[model samples]
Target: MAAQQSQGIQTLLEAEKEAAKIVQQARQYRVQKLKDARSEASKEIEEYKKAKEQEFKAFEASHAGTTSTTQAALDKETDAKLKEIEALFQSKKKDVVNTLLQRATQVQPELNRNLKKLQA
Candidate 1:
């Protein structure tokens, strides 16, 4: 009877050791899985960032041509307005000078009349 009791105690100790080993293995597997998940997530994020950067470069390349075309159109419009202003000034130049001369004569009539008589 004493030998049987000793064998039972030994069996219990063995079972306890087996349970501890299984628990330790489970913890190690969980840690390894977590590390693998983090590494995969980091890789996915880097790939997504690179893809977005490439998309932005493509957009910039496409818009560059439109920007130059728009700038050229604006330059042409500015040149047309400048030419129109020059033409308007040329057409009114003679009238503006005649008005100035009349105002000057009115301001000093005696000196202007004497100068006109001398010229005649």
Candidate 2:
């Protein structure tokens, strides 16, 4: 019937409008959250970096040799520790990546389940 077809179109149009509104609102919320997260992350990073630099400068100043002997001793120890940390990081980085990949593989089934539920 002509009337039925018109009514179906009207219903479909209204459903589309509602879906559009929901999608627009969700997009706006996501944009706001992303901006807020970025701002917070930048602020925290700036504070941390500033604090670390200040700490290092203070330490260097306090240790500011009345003598070259103390300065050389500090420099040597710092260099050795830094090299040790770098080697440790190089060895562990591959293990960290492998662990992440293994975890992702384990979660594949759960991800599929969630996708199925969302589609249903």
The lDDT per prediction is 0.96, 0.93
Measured against the true structure, the TM-scores of the candidates, in listed sequence, are 0.61, 0.51
lDDT of 2 by residue, 53-80 (tens): 9999998877776457778888999999
lDDT of 1 by residue, 58-110 (tens): 99999999999999999999999999999999999999999999998887435
How close to the true structure is residue 33 of candidate 1, measured as C-alpha lDDT? 100
Full-model lDDT, candidate 2: 0.93
lDDT, model 2, position 55? 100
The reply for model 2, stretches above 4 Å from the true place, is 66-120
Worst 10 residues of 2 by lDDT: 105-114
**Winning model by TM-score:** 1
